[model samples]
Target: MSEANAPRVRVLVADDHPVYREGVSRAIKARPEFELIAEAEDGRRALELVQELNPDVAVLDVQMPGLQGNDVLHAIKRDGLPTRVVLLSAHLDSETVYRAVASGAGAYLSKESSRERICDAIAAVARGEVVLSAEVQAGLASEIQIRERDQRPALTPREHEILVLTANGHSAPDIGKQLHLSQSTVKTHLKSLYEKLAVNDRAAAVAEAMRRGLLE
Candidate 1:
């Protein structure tokens, strides 16, 4: 099919590694339906190219000099660029996966993914689909579960001690005396606990803590 008549997907490839960028460029070139429009050696250049070329999809490295992949993604969104981003990273930690997805990245790919998988991700994003590698999916799932499990108000050790003392019928002054803190400081901790526990007073704070098993 002639280039003019063919349906082509324009792509921008960005990475700090010369070898890796070249490999990805070659992969994009190998597919007739895809066109390699631009390449960047850093996140800053990647954003520049995105503004200039406005490629349908951008393949960005998660770690790059000048700006990281997530930063680039935010820039694209801020500028209202009609580009879908596929983030590539060597690390697939839960936080990384969660952040990428949360930042509106179209896909998350590990550096160890096969060339075919990378190509598939690009195609998927071009088709307006959100793609997550198996590892990324697992990491995101685990992160979500952990966040849900730890949704309760977080209390510091000192706060826990204070709360326990308060539950045992100790006033702020008494608790402060036992913990070697000033009454004002004890009141400050109580205020913080009230906000965290979403309660108004001492009784409500203690009740919420007990309900969440935070006191135990």
Candidate 2:
């Protein structure tokens, strides 16, 4: 069908990683069936641009600097944006998969999925079909198994990063400056990490996190 005759799919991409975002944009542009309307590097921008663009579909990264993919999805719902969301991520657990499924996302795609798979995901979401990549499915299964075997403190990727920095003798202010967290936020994380790692000092906390594989 002609581009006009066929249903045109407008897409918005939201990813914090610049390389992945650009790769996705390039992949979409190389396809004939999809038109990429705008690009966003963070969750807030994603939500804002989606509202402005009113694209037919939005490809969102699950872990962003603020307002994660699901949070952005909620914002879209709250604002009644016309865009349908397709969550893209490098990692997600079974609980997260089910949660995203329940959160009105149109699709879930792992970043490791093939280029053709991405295009298919976009097309499927535009058609109101929910897509799940094979890698995403497998990762969810593996994550569930690991979760079942775990009875320890769970920290976010950013939190884990902070834990590592603090262990290396960085003060809260220094950690905040490096990771873009506030001083109070850095201290809060340090306190939480100390408690979680069962350490009384920064060195102890770092050692514990490293021992537990929470940090490199």
Candidate 3:
């Protein structure tokens, strides 16, 4: 199809800051390939408009009142909405980038990114491509490496201690005595460890932890 006849990609912009939202909205409006459908000042309203208008792409601020950008992204995924999402954040930490990428965001960009870059990301996302800025891409790579090196499930410090004691063949009550914790509390930690390790008993938990290098 000719460029003039091509359908514009519908877009929604949501940010708590009116100036930033307007700036982004204007950029979208100026793009010949994109159509600015709506603007929301908060996440809840963003989600509501998304459901109502079914835009092809949504540009969301990571931090917003009423519902976080991540929450809205999850809701869209849960409801199986066809709208692709582009997340914008002033904070671009590795953990944040990892979480956003893992949760199905089509793109993650710092708010400091150029308007042209944001517009390009929305266009790419609408075409079913994942877009990441250079900084975001580096952060995501670092986060993935950290995750890989620590393959163990999320265990609390107390749980790690319990696992160590259990590996030494200490019973739950014995562990409680050594740690000066109540027997019930020790058992609770043990139960949580088992659940996290996906094991049914202390021995299995210890073995799983060892295999996962949590004990090393």
Error of 1 at 98 (Å): 0.4
Clashing pairs in 1: none
RMSD over all Cα atoms, model 3? 7.0
Off by over 4 Å in 3: 152-216
Q: Over the stretch 1-216, how does candidate 3's per-residue lDDT look in tens digits?
A: 998999999999999999999999998889999899899999999999999999999999999999989999999999999999999999999998898899999999999999999999998999899999898888899999899777769888999998999999999889999999999999999889888888998778888988888998
Per-residue lDDT of 53-87 in model 2, one digit per residue for the tens? Answer: 79999899999987799899988887877788899
Let me know the TM-score candidate 3 reaches against the reference structure: 0.72
> How does candidate 1 score on lDDT?
0.92
User: What digit string (tens of lDDT, one per residue) describes model 1 on residues 11-111?
Assistant: 99999999999998998999887999999999999999999999999999999999999999999998899999999999899998898888899999999
Q: Which scores higher on TM-score, 1 or 3? A: 3
- Per-model C-alpha lDDT, please? 0.92, 0.83, 0.93
Name the better of 1 and 2 by TM-score.
1
